[model samples]
Target: MIRKRKHVISIGISATFLGIFFFFITLNNVHTDTYDIARFSTAGETIRSPITIENEQETERKTRETVQSVPDRFNISTEITQERVNYIEEVFDAIATLESEELGEKENEDDKETNGDRLVPLSNQEKVNRLKQILSEPITESLENETLIQLIISPQDDREAGRKLFVENLETVLNNGVRTENIQSAISEINQSIKYATLNEELKQPLTELSKFAVVENSFFDVEQTQEARKEAASNVDPVVIRAGEVIVQEGQTITNEIYEELNLVGLLDGQRNFFPAIGLALLIFLICSMIGYELYLLMKENKLEKGKLISIIGISILIISVLKLVSLFLTSENQIFYIVPIATGAFLLKLLINERVAIIFTALFSIISGIIFNGEIAGSLNIEAVIYFFFSQLAALTFLTNVKDRTSILKSGFGVMVVNIITILLFVFLTFEKYDLIDLLIQTSFGIISAFLSVVLTIGLLPFFETVLGVLTDIKLLQLSNPNQPLLKKLLTETPGTYHHSVMVANISETACEAVGANGLLARVGAYYHDIGKTVRPQYFIENQMSNRNPHDFIDPKESAKIIISHPYDGAKQLKKYKLPKEIIDIAEQHHGTSLLKFFYYKEKEKEKEREEVGQIDESIFRYPGPKPQTKEAAIICICDSVEAAVRSLNEPTEDKIEEIVAAIINDRMTDGQLDESPLTLKELKIINRTICGTLKGIFHSRIQYPLKEAK
Candidate 1:
């Protein structure tokens, strides 16, 4: 009932924790929009539009200044028309001037150079003059036509200058009286073409109008401008504030002005009713608590501790986990740290308080709870990789701890943790991470491995404190008990030599038998050496401690003898408890005899009962041992060893055959009486145990002839 009450209270505490965890989760999600204010807001205010009144005024002023600074547009068509007319007039005047020059040059060469080289030929001179005339004709005519067009149009002074020069040259050529009919004809054709110059004026008007229309028009609003304006508007708005306990939003509902305003002010809000997150939190709490409970069960069940100790162990474990959780939270926002703490705690607990299997279960529970608490970014949500890593790291740490005793084993176990952690991390990265790179992946793996190793060291350091404070009987505690120098074992050897010797033999036999059947041989041997230690209270009363003396029990009544024999198991149990022997060994000491009858005492009592027929029926239960039969193979083996050793010792001249028969008889008797019924030993295993015991006893009691040595004179 007390145990049930403690469990109920523990469950209640776990449930309360779970409830709070879920409440927080729900509050966070429903208030997410409020939370998003942190992302949206700048400083203590909302992000604002860029187009403020000052900015708009500045833009208008800049636009006005830009318009004033820009140069006025000019019409290219009007300018081109005047320039073309002037160019035509200039070409015609130049043609007329070139014709006059050609005629003069030909007349001079003919009159002055004839006698220079046997007189130039008239035909050659005529051909040269004609070629010069042909070239000058187009030039002179083109100039005359340009000058005439410029005169007719009264073109701009800048355009008419070249045409005026050409006309002057044409007049100079014509006054020379050189016959130039072809040049005059060309000039006349050019003059007729001068009428087309007015077309330029018509084209210029529409071109200038098109240029004026092409100027860009400013607009009241543009998309880019609007965005900037909105930004400025948002920036000008003040931040909103919300205090704790204010309902920022409701679940499954659209956000409202109140929610938005509150969120905007404070830059955060808690979640609302989120069922999945709440359920996940609840499950996480349950898993962690359940793991802790199961670990307590493992320790208690192994040590066979009483209800009080069981409660204390469980309470201490819960307290440790809680403290670790608190420490994990206080450390930082790094969720990996949370995982590291629990994993390390579990590993240390396994090394110090329980076995690796229990540690592994503990790690699993911690990983899940951590995922929920840290929200799965690090520990991973339903993360198969995280689960696998937790299991593998726990297994690695635990497996490497086999037969660990000293500080050096801690170092070795740490190395093992590193190896396993690396493998698990690699597996996770490859299987889960998408943007995988060798260097980053390796770094993550290395960090995990190093953390795992450090956890091992920390756990080893903390183990002794927990063991001493909690008075927990861990496997390490058992190993310590198995040491040869313990005071009780030393006292047993010194005070009662015969019993000590008997215990040593029983240790050997029991250890071998238990080992043969895959039981805890160290525990079996240790327990066997201490089982009959209470016989030292009256050493001579038990035959094993009688040292060649007459049997004292022979003088006592059979009922009294049976009473003395039956009292030893209980007495041994008490003595062991008084000395603080672990419950497992004490149970072995108490239950080794089970309820088997004392044959000699039983037969003698039957004879006495026949003599006193009127006496009430004998209570056979009283004659038998007060026993809870051997529940484990180790306890069963110890029982068999005790009986076989006593029976074998009774022989005056022990031989191999006799030892075998005696050992077999003890097994058959125990089996026939159903003392072995509750033990896990199978019939096949029992047969093997019997054969092993017979073989061992044969070697112990082997036959040898004694020879007399003669003395020489």
Candidate 2:
């Protein structure tokens, strides 16, 4: 519970530090400045738009103009043509009915009669009046009485011909649509067609007059259609936008009302405070911090998050953000200065000091921040080019720095980053299709080269600081310590050369086994080199150093021998601590010989006790090495390999079966005795370690075939 609380507190502190750093660094970029000048005033300096916005008033005006310019729509309804034709048909049909009725009346008055006796055959005026009553009011009112009377008095055949001609002419004129403006012309056309017909003057006059009644307006204005047309026109009008960084007013130029409104629209006017950009920036920071916190929590769960690593990550992130902020202060839309920021320095440092995952996470986070920082003074906009450039540059660094063996690898990785940066810049330029002069291209390319150089310089310079100040054990530090000239290694080599040889053998076997189990092979090898440093304190007491076949242990009491043997692990740990080596190295030195019973010494003392007939008086604890046990895979594997190496060396003629037997027996002893219980090694990994160790041992101790020798030929 206490450890859990500490992890939570550490995560909180890391998140808070990064959050505050990110917010303050990017705060000014998202902030907008208000101007004090008014409309129509002389400009002090050139003002650029802080935000992108639509000019609604200008857009509305364009829409209004577009809508007004759309002509009023009229509907040429087809039903009107049919209705007018029906009117003409009705008049002809009425005339036929009247003639039939009049004839019937005449026939009723006399079956057969002379023209004078035809009941004074109805007069044209009386006929007209009867026709008016018989026909509908509109038809009657439209045609004059004289036209009707002429139709009444004409011969039946002549009247039928006139009616047919009139109807034909009227239908033709009316079918062609007549609006309010063109109705008179349509009526005149009909009258001309009728007047030129082969009919009498009386009939012609009546038919000419009949054309007026037939032709009427057929087309009318449609309110809904006109409104719909205007709506469509309005929809097609595009909104006018004032883009961010657009010049609102030129320097030394009068600030017109238009420019003033534009400045106001972009929130550069007085009394304008857009907290939205700040809020958005805060949310972005929150998201980045949340991701970082989750990643740290995962590392903590995996037991990879040490205090030094956590501090290093926080320190690197703060340093990178601060540098970005400082560079962004002088940034302009015209200048591409962000390319020289040396962002890959953070990636190198993180990868070397910590792990790749943390480095990658921070790289991506920094890339996102780069988009905002290098936004060309445009708030609420992301510079996609900057994002892509940083992401690719850092990714190239990570890819090229596959092996962090030494500082030279970092320099080579910096070259790779430089190449990628140049290519990325070239890609942006080519994709834009803009013509860049040779000098301009060279200048941009130089920024990429400079950026890479800066990254290498900073990484090389700061690497030692982090290693020394934070006690972060990187691969480079391990490699440095692996050098044979180191003080502790030299002491171990000269004073205990036999022990040193044995240690070298153990180091080889331990490195192989640890690597097979997916542990730190370098660290395992380094630890093995110094694991038996305590033997240097009394080199002759150890069997390997007693070269003359004389036993130093034979003169010492068995109990006293156990005390000397048990002090070695602790003494080596003390020496390592005094030298201020990494804690991992100290752990290996301290925990290689865990609390396993020294059976040979214990049995020897037991035999003495048995001679006195007091076997139960021998305390088993006194013959055991005091230990906290191996707490890691590497340390645990070293413990098993250390015993296996010494035990294998004891055989007079070591065979493969003998080597395997001793290795398996020692591993079984460690497992059954619970010495490996505290270490994180699983049964499956231990099996892998067993196979790897046997393979390496076979290679180290393989036999050569003996040949029969004749007389010295």
Candidate with best TM-score: 2
Per-residue lDDT tens digits of candidate 2, residues 38-136? 778899998888788899998998999999999888777678777777776777778889888987997777855654454567777888888788788
Q: Which stretches of candidate 2 lie over 4 Å from their true place?
A: 34-48, 73-225, 248-273, 614-619, 709-713
The total number of steric clashes, by the backbone 3 Å criterion, in model 2 comes to 0
Displacement of residue 11 (Cα, Å) in model 1 is 10
Compare the candidates by lDDT and give the number of the best one.
Answer: 2
lDDT of 1 at 497: 80
Against the true structure, candidate 1 reaches a TM-score of: 0.57
Cα RMSD of predicted structure 1: 15.5
Model 1 lDDT tens row, 159-195: 3443444344333333332222344543433333332
TM-score of predicted model 2?
0.76
Count of backbone clashes, every candidate in sequence:
41, 0
